[model samples]
Target: MGSLHPAEKPKAIDLSHHLNNLSRSRHPSPLKDILKYMVQPGMISLAGGLPHPSLFPFESLHTRAYAPDSNLAPGETKHGVVDIHIPQTSASTSNIAIALQYGPGTGCSPNLVSFLREFTARVMQPAYADYEILIHSGNTDGWNKIVNLLCEFGDYILVEAHTYPSAQALWAPMGCKGAPIAMDGDGLLVEDLRRVLANWETDHPGVRRPKLLYVVPVGQNPTGSTMTFERKQAVYALCVEYDIIICEDDPYYFLQLPAYAPPASRKQESQQDEQALLASLVPSFLNLDYQGRVIRLETFSKTLGPGNRLGYFVCNPIFAERLLRATEVTTQTPSGWSQAILAELLSAWGQSGYLTWLRNLRDSYAIRRDWMCDLLAERFDLENSPVPTEGVLAFAKGHGSRADRKQLFSFVQPKAGMFLWLKLNLIGNPEYERLRAAAGPNVEAQWNEAFWMQMIEAKVLLTPGSYYTPWEGRDPSPNRRKEEGVTYFRLTFAFESHEEMRLGIDRMARTFELSWNLVA
Candidate 1:
């Protein structure tokens, strides 16, 4: 991959005004700042407390890494395995000695740091000339640093109506609230964002509009929506108009799969060259960002392993400096072991090999996604939605007559990420319909809980919708409140085997059939 940036590009717009007091007050750690001096040749320094690689207890670390093009399926390691050794001595550039030693928050190993920079520049291709990268201990740490850097107590921030719960939880203690914008299958609506920001005082009296926007554009957490290039352009334009900073937490960016094709319509998957693969995908917010207002939080968690706990930020230098200070006090960097291992593997594979691996992983997950959708089709009378949203499913099996058939649940077969966001149709279920009519308020919550408990009793586990649903009293839609009347579940095809997926889906289908009084 080559740079999408031109020879001359604009520098980032000064977004310093948006920073809170804490970020403005941040100063580089004096001891950490001295690190630039240690890297010089023949510099015999005893300035900061540092460990010698020879004295380190660990000698050699032997690791068998799956090759870049591994099948990534269960028991598919036979595809290829690359041997890696992290030597204790400083013989190699990214040896264990230096990795295991205390290092800067920016990164542990220069080799890994260099690798990421090239990866971001070549793959992510940020539009600006001066975009900088800062490594951290994955998206959680990355977001935490940003939260501390940008958020003052009692500030509001824009989030998807259905957003990541943990992120919202992280800022709540500081009195920051979520100003959730409406979303459809595509993602958070651009108009909704404009409406919120443009009419802040009128719509939300006693409080000002938010200055920060947190979004998971690719494979959004609960909704599994991926914003198209035009959609992102619109969203970015709105952010620019409103002077808002966009925080892109896209862990599943590489897990991007193709649109759903029924088996009959399926086409053979082809290997994509690096450039072709790059062209096929939607560019990141960073790529569209000329002003460097987008703070992209990317992670190896989705592609490699979550245990790696390695992620990085692509943002302007101003924000990077403040985030570095936050990291000094909290999670400094990813584990040295993680850095060394990743560096060795990445160095061996190189950029092209890694992209091949990502494509393979994407294809494998797509097959798993198809499998889950197939199971859903087998277990119920899954049909085209009446509304006819592409890639969406509606399932219902009436007792006998076709007229009795009603949509019990539906989901947009996600083009990215692992989870299927199943939207329940409570009005379609006869039992639920009768209850909704007879029972007064909160009936949906009670019934949904009871059904979820039944699924639990039947040995099926799923995350409840309420967990991802943003806190109430903020959304300005009456129809949006209708989401409350329905139940939802996030089913994953990432970890489980095909057999396990079958069993789980079987249990779920049976549970739905029995609970909804539908015929098999």
Candidate 2:
């Protein structure tokens, strides 16, 4: 796919006619509006029940040295170490005085808000003229607020075939239904999306037309499929045509990996080459949004740490204000301490230093990804092997040798993110095929349960694909039936150490060989 040039003009969208009823009803908080002017010079009036900063007892905070480089030698003491310190004073942005005291529900600290604004302008560069940002607890919290603000009960939410489990959990309890769109090696297919929308009324009689699309565009959860710039453009065009609001939940946007190459094919590159690769990532939906239809949910969970519980929403002013009102009633604001600490770090790092940090993170994850993929390849004995037996390849006109047909498993080498989605050869398993025939309507669920148990016994744990699958009642596409009984697993290469990753894969390989009766 070709890259989107910054100078190219994006097609404009009319957002005023696209807002949901709840969004249209929401208005800015009166208290929050007045709090902004309360912080003027030499103005010390008692306002919205804010506590005295002096009563707080915290004197100072200190953290251990942080080294960006992970390749330090065992005895390396003076190579690079920077200790972080925050004093409890009224002057500093990291001061405990403001952190402990009550603050705006929209954002805790002014300095942190300013830093994020600059970061978003430089990185995302949303094309909309009247965009706004609001800090919240995290992506999960942000998603909940979005769902409440945009969707009514029993509304339809369009989602990828396999998506984040937590999103499904949030939608189910609220009486919202998921209409699954088919996906491929490159994430959500634009063709499938068009078909679903075109035949919505016929396929789903009496159901409300879906107005919301929830997608993890970059390094999509579980699937590990990154949508190309062209694919995003096509999907955005559909959204405009259908007047759907896009909730872009992209936590792994910055964790994108470089183009895949065999281990031996990789050669050392210069710093300039590495920098160029980072700058050449696919543009986000927000960048393409000419109208205010896309609400981007960005989190510190993936980049900084989940413990911080901080994230922000970037949307058109209309939706942003409504989301802020929703936030006022729910989480109110993200942790003040987290906001202060992040502001301090970003102020010190600046724009260039922050980009450098992201590059370091990407490189580290890439190392882990390479290690896991290489190990899986060795375990599967896929060295110079043809494509394995699967849906698309099974009935191909020109088939390869019998040896290729004997291969029992395969996976798409993830271009980005921490997951490796392994597609199991359940069709080749005698027990699976036998049970599938006579297990009645609940066959798919039963088979998935049995397969999960076997993997657990083999001492290799993984998230079953069923968790990511959309609800059956809401999915009317014929493609959903074909995937109902399919066996797949999601493995994360983020938390495990190198030794642990290898050992887990080794156990999983043994189980695969025994189950499929494959020769070593």
Candidate 3:
């Protein structure tokens, strides 16, 4: 576990080969380029479609904001108000006049960008010095840009066997195919990645090797798997070897939680400092990206609010310039209102406050994580055990064929993010094969759909794991693919109260019991 502190300046690597024809043909906006002259001393600007702030309908914007440490357990949440009054005239980036006007595609303005760049430098400590940031709508928007930058029609993109479905869906419509790499409880399996990359020509014949890899390294969307530092090192090495650009779509990086233990075995708490907090997190890919191939998609959606629709790319300045060109054409900027509010709010919080806010969020999510797992364990008679992978814990119901067994489900307790990836022993249900054959070619999915509908009938809604499958992954856990007789469902502990969670889990358990005919 080496420190992520910067050891060297980043060296430029030519990744232009990875760019698609469409992106290569793009040029920066001519009008946006002219804004450079608009800032000169007392220049009368008639350059762009500039709306005079005087004609703007609103005089100011105001909202009550949350405190940095809001929502801590056993304490009342504190709040504050951010007021942006559009003064008659002011040149400050944080002023309401500038906030309400046209903004750069880099962000709505330099206000949020400056705050974020400082925060990234201080907290994330990207190992590369030449890295740049470009704000987009969020991870979804950020991902779309990456796909456009690299993936041409019919290009294959590497992805974890299970990934954020939307990321896969974004490129699938472009006629590109998904090259799924195997994964486990610790996220991407390096050997499996190497296996795919090393054997690409043998497998695909004339198809080009995938030039881009999309992964959710923290609290994997469907699987709730977190990558360890060693795992990231290995993955990064493979990307470098294979000459692939890594699109690290890590919205949940700050949601990293401590290992779960049953209440009886749970340890007491200790005071956590900023350094300790940073140390606890698995370093971002940017930390290991000396050659600048990693485009780490950082977002304020999870950290702040999703409605803000703001996120940014941290990568080599070369790739960033191309992405900036793309942005200059499409989503020229995020909502100006969003950037201003966030800029004000974050400035109020400062870097220390931001970390404190993140700490509070991490703790809150961890509590909910505990609540979900604890309820499941209580209802299922689960046996908790340490999995072979680092940062992974699992729960399993009895595997025996005893007639008294009522239901069966297995899951990996999440180490980060909002999901609990669970596998119900649908094979434990008597009609497994009947349902399997009924679905024909799409057996796993249709079979899982039957179970999902059963849960819906029972008034509990959990996402079918099939939705998150990058390809046709038989099992959510790559290590357990050989072990069949199970179907996957993804549940989130991020929303709803403890009582609601319990009620849902109870209903889920009862549904399984009835399906197994263990209930009269």
lDDT scores in order: 0.83, 0.75, 0.79
Ranking of predictions according to TM-score: 1, 3, 2
lDDT of 1 by residue, 18-55 (tens): 88998888777788877778878998888978877788
lDDT of 3 by residue, 1-520 (tens): 1134444565557778888899999987898877677878998877778888788777666577777766665234565544444343456646566767776678656767888888778777776677787888998999999999988998888888777888877877787777777778889899988988898888778978888998999999899999998999999988998898999999999999999888889885674788899989998887777788889899889889899998899888778999999998898878877877788788877888889889888988888899998887786666544555523322224523455553466677789999988766666467677866566665666667877899899999999877876653233223324435656788999888889989998898787776676664
1 against 3, candidate with superior TM-score: 1
Model 1 lDDT on a 0 to 1 scale: 0.83
Q: Which candidate is the best by TM-score?
A: 1
For candidate 3, the per-residue lDDT at 462 reads 90
- Which residue pairs show backbone clashes in model 1? none
Scored by Cα lDDT, where does model 3 land?
A: 0.79
| lDDT score, candidate 1, position 26 | 76
For candidate 3, the per-residue lDDT at 122 reads 76
Angstrom error of the Cα, residue 279, model 2: value is 2.9
Better of 1 and 2 by lDDT: 1
Task: Please provide, for model 2 over 1-520, each residue's C-alpha lDDT reduced to its tens digit, 9 standing for 90 to 100.
Answer: 1134435535334565555677777676777766778888887777677777778878877764344443322223533555667778857557887777667777768888788887776777777656678998999999988887778878889999898888978878778778889887788999999998999998888988999999999888888888998999999999989989999999999888876566899765444343474467778898778777899999989888999999999887767767777776667777888887887777766776667667667767877887888777565555332532121221111122454444454567777888878666566566667777776776657777876788799888999887898864644455454754357789998888788989998887776666655534
Reference-based lDDT, residue 1, model 1? 10
Cα TM-score of candidate 2: 0.89
